[model samples]
Structures are given as C-alpha cells and as structure tokens.
Target: GRKGDEFAYSHVVARAFDTDHHQLRISSARLHDALQGAVAAMSEPMVSHDAVAFYLLSEEVSRHVKVVQSGQGADEVFAGYHWYPPLAGVDGDDAGATLDAYAGAFFDRAHGGVCDLLAPEWRLDHDASRALVAEHLSRPGAGTAVDRALRLDTQVMLVDDPVKRVDNMTMAWGLEARVPFLDHELVELAAACPPELKLASGGKGVLKEAARRIIPAEVIDRPKGYFPVPALSHLQGAELDLVADALHDPAAKERGLFAAGAVEALLRAPNDALTPLGGNTCWQLGLLELWLQAQGVR
Candidate 1:
C-alpha cells in the first residue's frame, strides 16, 4: 500500500479543499477476514480487487455519513480507459475491424482461450462475449470507433460492473451513493462531444481540464491511481491455501466448471498463469467455486 500514490493525492486534494478529512487504513489480516463478507455483498463472481476495498470503506463511511458522492461513471462517460485512445481514428464502417479492435483491448481473453479453461459441457457453442460486443458496437448512435467503445463501456459494462460494485457495497452498509457523472443530461452532452476531445491528454482530458480550476495542478497531472491488494497479487502462505482449499473441495470437484488439466496447471504455479489482462488465473478460477459454494448452489 505504501507503494501507491492514492493516499498522497487524496491527502493533497483533501487539504486543498480544507474539508474535514479522516483516513482509514486496513491490514492484511483485516482484509482477509472481510473477504467473504465482501464477496457475499457483491452476490456475483467478479474478481476485481476494488470490490473489497469499497465494501470495507463503506463500512467506515456509513458511520460518518448516510450518503456519499462517488466518482464512478466519470471514466466511462469521459473515456478514461487505456483502450479509448487506441480506438481513435479506426474505421467504424469496418465492422470486423472495429470488433477486433475493441475486443482486443477490452476482453480479458479471446473466446477460444476461455473455452480452453472450461469442461466440455460448460463450453458455449458460440463466442458469446464477441457477439455481445459486436452487437453493442454496431448500434447506430455511436459514429466512430472511440464512440462505440465509450458507448459500450458507459451503457453496458459500466452499469453491470463498477456501478453495481459501488451500489452493492454502499447499500450493504445502509449508505446511499450518488453518481453525478451518470446523470442523463451530463452523459448526453458528453456523448455528443467529438471522440478525439475525450481521447486527448491521455484520456478524460475534458474532465481533467475542468478539474484544474478547482483542484491543485499536481493532482490533475499525476498518473492515475489504482486500488491494488498486494497480498492477493502473488498468493502465499494462508492466502494460497485459501484458494487451494476452494478448488480442491469436493463441491468444486462435483461442479466440474473447469477442466482438471487447466485447474491443476494453475494450482502448480498459481502466480505464473495470468490472463491476457494480467489477472491471476488461480484466483479467477478459485473465485467462481468460492462464490458458488457461498451461495449454496449445487
């Protein structure tokens, strides 16, 4: 956690505004104990480390305030992801090329790679992930490759992923979280702006420029910060055993969601096998079984 700039920038912004600011730090032991509760609150199998941090943070925030404003949709609405910049100037008329570009950047693994990890019965007859993205990209309202990418992310992925994560975690703690960036009027205006504008200054240039008027320049110019749980990155000691136990459990064996060879390979070198997006393969597989078991599903 000491390696992260999140705390530093947060302190700078907090002091600049001169609002009543408090800090909450969590230890590995506390995070481990809170893991199941975080997973349970999500009520779905998402492997992002952000969920646990939000869940734990909401627990603290609820004690201070009943409602909080979260900067969740700003990235999607303003095109703040790495993929957005690359999609600029691509031929939107070429459906195949557009889909290839978007999927190449967004999907963690190709459908073929995904099928390799599943047992035969669990494998799908088609590339469902590709099909979904293709349909979203082909929609009429978006004019360019970047627009299509932003549309898909803001309308589809953002709603189901990060937005849901914030909602579930805050609601679990009896706190209400409001997202102003997602307001229909603001989103419509942002959507109408040229894709190149949103893609400038690395990404979300418009938002960053507007922020400069209010916040310090150092924060506006700093590299983006991500929430990382170092303990989970390369599993060791009790953390490794926690994942090993879940995959080895009789329930996991009965479910047969994953092929034995793939599971065994990941277990043998848990830290080495990573997805295209660099997610830990061992944790991804273990998380599914862990979630199913938590939900009491057969």
Candidate 2:
C-alpha cells in the first residue's frame, strides 16, 4: 500500500497473509532477482510483469517463512477482479456474443499494448498465443456471462498471473506457497455461488460480506489494488541501456521480437514521458534480456 489505502496498514497486512509487504521502494536488485527467477521458471521467453513484481516480493518474505498460503483462486472463484463488471451488463444471446468478444481481449494488454509495439515482421506468432487462450475460453462450464467470465479468468489470469508468480518467486528462494482458495471443496462452493452475489455492481459482493465479519469493513469495502514494480520510473539512463543492449543483441536480433527502429525510438524518448504501452514494452524488453542472459542466450 503506497499512500491512500482504505484500511490502516496493520489491519490490511494481517489479513493479507504472506502476500502483504510494508515497503515503498522497488530497488533495481529486486528487479534483477525477479528476472533471474522468471528465466529459470519459464521453459521459454514469455513474461508476466505482474508476476515479476510479486515474485520479487515473495523472495523477500521467503527469508522469514518456509511456507505461505495465498488467496489466488478466490478472486477468480469469487469474482473479485475489476474486469468482471464489464461482462455483467449483458445476458442471454448477446451475453454469449459479448463473452466471445471479451475472450479475445482477456490478454489484450500483453497482446495489443506490448506485443503490438513490435513490428509485424518481428512479432511472435501472437495468433498462436491467442489460440491457446481461445482453447481455455471454450472449456466446458455452466454459468452466466459473469460466471463464464470468472471461469475464463480462472483458466487464464489466476494460473498465468498470480499463481505462477508466487510459485516461481517463492520456489526461487526454496520456499513453498499454497493457495487455500483453490481447495477442491472451496472451489466448488465458490463455483456454486450466484453471479449477483459474487459480482455485484463493482465486484466481489459475496467476498465483501464474508470479509465484513472476519476483517475490518474499511478493508473489505475498499477498492481493489495490487503491488507493481516501479518500471516506468526506472526506464532511463544506464537502466535503459541494459534494455537497449538487449534489444540490439545479435541473438535477440535473430529472434526478431522487436523492430530495430522501434528500439531506437524507445531509447530516444526524453525523460520518463513514454506512454503506458511504451513503458511496459521497455520493461518487457529488459526482463526478456535478463531472462535471455540467465538462459545463456545473450
């Protein structure tokens, strides 16, 4: 929590379990450590910036704790993400059509925001990546448009983002993490919850009710949030060079994941004024380089 958390830090920290941290700064060393773990964890070069940040935090907590429990599936199972609200408005035939459209956008940022930064000739087979997601969208399930949205997130977001981040980050430090929300019975219970209860106006209606008694109302009712690395601010000077070098590397050139002209434009940007897409791409390129280095590819 940086500044304006709804609940006092101490109470939120207690209830958040191992995922909570009382820090403000994101040092370069933590970023480097996270990239190392990302490379080792991945069989290839796919990156999750969200996981990179969390994995770094998990590394720190692993020093004191040998095992930790998380609320990973709870959000997906209980409909806690902000993305759920958009899907709740439609129903019946149009709802299915909307979900079909939404499925294409589930990873829209990583695809459109970051991947689109690359030149068409240089971009990876993003369609192949999207096809993989489309498979999950087509998974056997029964539920409303919102319920389908929840299932879609469970299939993609929960596993790819949080769970992977925690698992890799904790394991990098020889720690183990468990997710109680993923328990078989608990998952069934969450699945059985009504959409209106799980995904009200904003989202997480039922979870708020459950949290009301167990945790402070302020914490329960507060807007959702998560920690992220300060990559946008970190993208300048020598730090940018590390990323620029990676983009210009002979091996990276061979892979052709980015356009050389686009790389130079990124390097030439003045100060930290790049757009959200630009900042995210810089971080992605840097992490990919770090991962490649760990793989002995660059």
Candidate 3:
C-alpha cells in the first residue's frame, strides 16, 4: 500500500495467490508489456538498444528476479572516451599537454570550475600530490602500461565500486542480485585482452566489434549513454539531515566503524574539502551503523 493502491492490490493478490506468482508472474508480465510498448514506440535501431529486453529475457530463462551488471570496465579497457584517445595518441610535450588537459577537465568537473573549492589546508602539497598522482596513475604488478591500467581498474574501480550500491538496493527489496558480467572468467578474459586490440582505432573498439557479432550492428554502433539515476540530485532536506544524524549518533560512534574525529573532520570541512577523511568514510560509517543495528551488535 505504501507505493499506492495499484502496488497494494498487486501485493495482496500476489501474496494470496502464490509468492512466485507475485514476483515472477505479475512483475515479469508488467515489465514485458511495458518494454514491448516502448520498443513499438521507437524506431528500428532504437528498439535494438533494449538492454532491458535482453536482461528480462535472461531473467526469464534463469528464473532470477533481480540482476545487477556493470558496463564500465570495457569502456575503461578500450579507451572509449574522447579524452583517452588523444592522451594515448600523444608523446613527449604533446602527451604532457594531453595529461594537463585531462587534469584540467577533471578539476573543472569535480571542483565546479572554482579551484578555490579545494581548501588550501586540504589541498595536496606539491610533493605529496606528485607521489599520490604517480601512485594512482601508475600500473602496479603489470609489465606494460596498459596491463597496469587494467589491473589497477579491476582492483579498485571494478571490484570495489558497486559492492555497497548493489547490495543495499537489492537487499532493501529482499531480492537476490546476480552479476553475470562480474564472473571470474569474464574478469580474467577482459584483463587478458591486448591493449592494442581493446583500444584500437578509438573508443571501446573491441567491445563494439564483439557486440556486432551478436547484437544488431546499429545497437553496437550507437554512442553509449550512462544509466540514469536521480539519487544524488534528490538527496536533500530529510535525507541530508538523516546522513548528518547517522554520522553524529552516539550508537554509531560507539560502534567504532570510523574514528569519531574523522567523521567530525569530514562534516566540519568544506563541501569540496580534499581531506583524506572526506571521501567514502561517511557512507562507510553509515552502512556499518545500519549493519550493527540490524545484527543487534551494539
């Protein structure tokens, strides 16, 4: 009933009839019907870009109600963006200039075009910045630069990036989420693909070529778009207050998920505070508090 009358009726009927019927029967039916209607409304190539349709088809065969997949790694692997191609093409001064351009673009986006947003106290001092940047941009445990890039990405961004988001969202609905693309085999295969093959001729060239073999060429060729979510934009008022509350809550503090001083420093710091304490620590603290509360861990 919380989602309204239609959802309540569907819930009751689903519960009264059969549990599987509610989840698979009603939900799948509605999803399929809506997708069909959407496809019909669009043009030939547009209909082919139906990732939802492909997902639903997989779901039907596997009887899995929920799935989460990330499409970012391939893009990263194959220099898919406008920036990466130019960076890769340059050498000597041109390469240095390209890196500067990339850094400028990142600063503009991350700092809202105001360099002053990064507080002087928290800003990376020259030596520290150089070391940090070197460490971050260097490829560890790989022979080639490309290999190192893949290893670093797989270790940090691909593996760790989506864990909390996927877990929290799926668990909220009491649904099991499967990530087929994250299968060990797929990860290894992606890592092993040659950089020249992966990044050939600009964009995620290899992935696009592979997709053409199975998917319609039109779908494969289309410019990629990010999956849309309004969560960050909508976090305000009660939501922002809830975050503040959780950070300062005595129970949360007692749980010792994060050092109290660290949490305080993050809150007290400016929005663009470059302090090491100001990154994912707040969310990590909040999730840890929720986990403690759920498990009665005190």
Candidate 4:
C-alpha cells in the first residue's frame, strides 16, 4: 500500500542457528535452505514438520518479526562448536599459557594501532594502556584465558546478545517469542564439558567430529555467518537524525527515559560526527522511545 503496488510474496525465515560472530556470512546458505524448506513444506498439507516450518515462515513474512529459537543451546547440547581446542601436543597448562601470550601480543598490537589513530589528548601511559588492553582480554569465568573467552561469549553473546535485535524486531511486529537456549538444563550441560574436549584443534573438535556422522560434513563444516544485517548502514540519514532528535528533544526529556541534559550533551558532542554510535545504540534508543510511548510515560 505504501508503494501503491499489488504483490504477494512468501518469506521463510530462520533464527541464528550458529554462534559465529559474523552471522551474515555464516547463515546465508542456511537461510536459503530454510526458505526452500518452508516453501516445500507449505505445498503439502501441514505435517508436524510443516507446523514448525509455517511458524518460521510467518516470521519471515512479517516486516519485523523476531523469532526466539534456541539453535545455540542445541549446539551446546549436541556439542555444536564453540569449544576451545588445546594446541597439538601441548599440556593443558601450556596451552592456556600459549593462548594468553597470543592474546596479549594481539592486544598490544591493536592498542598501538588505536593509539596511533586517536588524538594526542586521548593518549595514555604504558600502565594505563596495558590495563585497557587487559580489560578487553578479560572474560567472565574463572580458568584459562581461552576458557574465560568462551565463558564471556557464552554469557554475553549467546545468552543475552540475541535479545537486542530479536526482541526489538519481534516486538516491533507485535510478536512474542521464547528462546529455549536460555534453558538452564542445556547451558549447564555445555558448561560442564572440559575445555580440551570442546576446543580441540580441529574445530568444535568433539562436537563437530561427532555430528559429522549424523549431519553431512558439508552442512556441519559450512562456515558460520551469523546475523549479517547491515545495521549501521540502515541507521543512517533520516533514521540517525530521528535518533538524535529524540535524544536531544525537550519532549523526550519530559518523558524522562534519559537525563535531558546528558542526552543533549550526547547530541551536541562532536564525537557523534566523527564516531557515530552504531545502529545497535540507535535501535536501543528507538526501542526505548517506543516502549515509553506505549506506556504513556512520555
């Protein structure tokens, strides 16, 4: 109606089944497969599989539908990847040390690059610099550096990160979803596994090797590309201005999700021009405004 066109299309959507950071690159093929599967399932009378297929299909059809499914938890359950493998012939302790050293060296190089790019006023001394580097390297769990890294990702990424995009989009379309990955039982099982077994040198060492017999190696071994939405690109121009306006507007201040003066400062600050807050931040602000509006709080 907006475009004054008459057309009907079917969409088949799938959740992020893999844990790869770059979901776009990882899930492209899988998404295609899902859409094909949905279309095929639709042609036949609704079987049990079709029921699942159609639910996912409806999500695809909606302008902004977020389906909360638990593909990540399933991976962890069946030992699907994300387990850090020990380097060949290295003792557990040594393997941990090797990873830590590698991380530290990488951090130092990255810090140097960032420092070179930053203004002179932002520069810090060696101790401060190393501390900042350590903050980036540190993770949530106790144990080796690699273990901690895995824990951090599991805690922050797999558990909580999905909500940022998924919940927002789903709610935007007036849908509610429950993710099974947040299941306590599944997370406990995955967390109980020894790191050596999980991160074996050959990629999700144990899980991948085990799954090869059940699922084709091609399917299991396919490179993972997670949600690859060009979020930043989507949030530019009018969208960015809308966000900026909401943040700085007196009416937004009266609504009071944020401190009016602080929001104004953020808007007026020069940093937004040079290093604009990315789409995630903009989306979050928009969602907050939407929620406030719904509650009649603003």
lDDT of 2 at 78: 87
Give lDDT per model, in order: 0.84, 0.64, 0.44, 0.42
Better of 1 and 4 by lDDT: 1
Return the number of clashes found in candidate 3: 0
Tens digit of per-residue lDDT, candidate 1, span 175-213: 999999999999999999888788778788888888888
**In what order do the candidates fall by TM-score, top score first?**
1, 2, 3, 4
| Candidate 1, position 206, lDDT | 84
Pull out the clashing pairs in model 1. Answer: none
Model 3: per-residue Cα lDDT at residue 70: 38
- Write down the TM-score for model 2: 0.78
In the range 1-298, model 3's lDDT, one tens digit per residue, is: 0110133344654555465542333243454344333322222212112223333333453445554453535555554645444344433233235335445433213332122323344344354433433465553345444454455455654544343344433444344556655567876776677666767655667777876665555445554444321221222344344446765677765655553256566555323333231233333334344445545557
True lDDT of residue 23, candidate 4? 15
Deviation (Å) of 113 in candidate 1: 1.7
* Candidate 1 residue-pair clash tally: 0
**Where does model 1 exceed 4 Å of error?**
1-5
Best by lDDT: 1
TM-score for all models, in order of appearance: 0.96, 0.78, 0.46, 0.43
**Cα RMSD, model 3:** 13.0
